[model samples]
Target: QDNRISIWSVGDLGNVGLNGEYQGEPQLLCDIRHNGDVMDMQFLDQERIVVASSTGDVTIFRHHQNNQTLSANQRWEKAHYHVDRQASCGGAACTGVICNNPEIVTVGEDGRINFFRADQKGAMRTIDNADSSTLHAVTFLRTTEILTVNSIGQLKIWDLRQQRNEPSQILSLTGDRVPLHCVDRHPNQQHIVATGGQDGMLSIWDIRQGTMPVSLLNAHEAEMWEVHFHPSDPDHLFTCSEDGSLWHWDTSTNVSEKPSFLHQGGRSSTYFSHNTINQSVVSAWLSNDPTKDRMEITNLIPNQTLSVNSLDVLGPCLVYGTDAEAIYVNRHLFA
Candidate 1:
């Protein structure tokens, strides 16, 4: 719980064996003290990093590659806060932050969304009341559009080009509002989005279609913490949960090609209508025929039961952090 941002260089993982374990310790690059509890962080670029805090402040830090030290660059103080009868209360936590090179977007418990440029000290645009509840996470659907998940299981889409502060569209879960915790968009298909909720269910949505999600897959046993699509291979998905499990979902196999007798005459219909979707271009996530829609799931951590808080997958590497104050790296993900 010590609010600190530490950087480490995981030396060449090429030596990691087929077992996927790396016995060597990561080399400490630098450690910097943060203003408040670090809520989220992202690399602004190779030389800079952006951090969001519980104090509702967002700061950019410069990492000196040669000296291996960090220096504060730009700071946006009190970017989010609760207003009561014209008085601003203690700053609300900036829960999520995303970077799009020069542009930075932050969402907070105060239900505010702030947009900033790396060179500017002030927010370029502010959506004062983006949501009535806390915004948990955000991701860019397109260069000009962003999607945000809130405390009440609602996903709202905002268009940056619009002068209006209101969201362009809203989508939500069917029943009791299970707070959504994390979200990630498909690397290859911008229209496909995945969200994880407090109920541990994984919902896949085609933002171009109806308001409801296309598929709701039963996943973790406890609150699902994070979900990510492999940066290079969109067919591979990763999810970590409070139940202390990290799962790898593989949809690479051609399960859709297998003929199914479930459809007697016409095209097969599954959880969602795929009649219009071209099989060759359609994502396996939108597979028709429930009988043939099979996804192989592998639990990465089966023994430990402490919460797996966050995870990221890039190429053949998979790294995750846990509530037990440990970070695990699996280098041979594809093997």
Candidate 2:
């Protein structure tokens, strides 16, 4: 953890701090308070973090851990059109963002998803209405295909292959109605994704299978704001919620209990982003696969006021923030 730094953002404030270090007290190396609340963020690399804001802006911050300096650069100002509050959809507001080098994708309340290339002046292509309700998050499954969750907990898969502007497949998070707040796919097994939401429900989904969750459970007292699969450990999951809690979910123990991998030769596949229509690119293990047991969860933070809105998992360490304007550091979350 020598050169590692931790970053977190919530509401209007964001901070970058030295990781695994605190002699007497913890302190921020850089603090950024944006014009509006921060909605979503992703680390581009060791130096840059991409951020999306409620005010429709997507910005990038470059960090220098050696000097503890942070600088900001505007990527896209007024990235989406927030609808007028009077009309009901709470006026368009940006919700989340993800960066995959040459391209960056940002989603928002107005159901807009704009695709920007790092060198381009404006969006290369824009799905003006990706959904009817607010788009909470967007992720690249194969780069050519993307997944989005809306306020209604509806998951839509868009195949960039066609010139048309509609999703190839749409599914619901649950039979009962509950809004979804966040979604994260497995770092290695792209089709396996996790979702957390308004009802505090945590659901594991294998997009290739049927629409229903393989397993679902109440993960938090309040809304589960973020659900992430460890980058290095696929079996472990990390979640933080509005109940002001941070959790370490260790499914590593269950790895040995898992059924054997799906039989191959039963199927074959090929893939990319925005190029070929559905199947030529998007492929799944198969339908009717059995569900595994629920994961083992540890509450790293027992309790707190307001929501733990942001978090990031780094090896055996973790960092998360709460709506109370507080950030927590767990130097040995796994150890």
Candidate 3:
């Protein structure tokens, strides 16, 4: 249908094209992007797209130019640079970035999440800090807190309530044998958050606690890549791994004396990415709750064959970048 939006992916070698169910074949919209490799591309609402490169530069583009042959609207050189060195780094280096309402936070191999305020002035600043251990992922908990996870299995929670300061809480996955690969917080409740580590572990925590995790759920059979919680449900979570699988779990189901492994068998996959979810599915109560139990049922979309290097979800749609120099837009085409 013409109502559906078109999807596009640009390769590291500068091959940019579109992917979708259009006519007899997919279409190539244009080849305007000129980076040696597109390290990370994020859509801000529907009008603008931001692309980060391995050269430690950032560029902003308007989604659709009036002329189809035209490329992105405006380009900037060395948008994100190390305050100390003022140089560029190579590909596959930027680990995490989050576009908070008015600002954007990005972290690269330098172990710092540089902050940029989206303004007419277009100024950049380092508003906060995290543990300097290979900042793998960074996200905002509500608007005031920033949750950052490093390669060392440590989760740093920075309180933006305090202006331009370090984190107020530092939680480490020290007891677990694996290093955390990704971390995500509950969209509705700032108190709850989840982490996925190298050992295929999914540990959930309450932000108030000093160090103890609320629960540890082994949701995958291999090294876990990412963990995502349903946008509206605090108890419904998803995990993906190199094991070529995506697992969904309802934390409420663990209330019974029965072992969690029986429920752990629920797995789905289309391509391997960081996290997955459904928008309509809201809160789900634990099975044994006195009130009626609510279950958020999400169908697992199939994944592409290339190793998924990065994955992100917005509402019902998911965008993932793979090691094969391709990105995929996996929509619920049938369901």
Q: What is the C-alpha RMSD of each candidate to the true structure, in Å?
A: 3.9, 8.2, 9.5
Question: Model 3, 164-260: lDDT tens per residue?
Answer: 5677788776554356778787775566677887777767766664465655655555677777775654455666666655555654443333222
Pairs that collide in candidate 2 are 11-37, 82-92, 83-91, 83-92, 143-273, 144-272, 144-273, 144-274, 242-307
**Candidate 3 wrong stretches, greater than 4 Å:** 1-28, 34-37, 68-92, 120-124, 127-129, 176-178, 232-236, 250-306, 314-335
Of models 1 and 2, which has the larger TM-score?
1
> How far in Å is the alpha carbon of 241 misplaced in model 3?
2.4
**lDDT agreement with native, every candidate:** 0.84, 0.69, 0.55
On lDDT, who's better, 1 or 3?
Answer: 1
How much is 160 displaced in model 2, in angstroms? 2.6
Over 4 Å off, model 1: 84-89, 255-280, 288-293
Total clashing pairs in model 1 = 0
> Tens digits of per-residue lDDT for model 1 on 266-312?
65543333333223234677653321456788998899799998887
Specify the poorest-scoring 10-residue window by lDDT in model 1.
271-280
Candidates sorted by lDDT, descending order? 1, 2, 3
Q: Which consecutive 10 residues in model 3 have the weakest lDDT in total? A: 282-291
Model 2 CA RMSD to the hidden true structure, in angstroms: 8.2
Q: Write the per-residue lDDT of candidate 2 for residues 95-126, one digit (tens) a residue.
A: 98988886789899888998887657788899
Model 3: how far residue 246 lies from native, Å: 2.6
Which one wins by TM-score: 1 or 3? Answer: 1
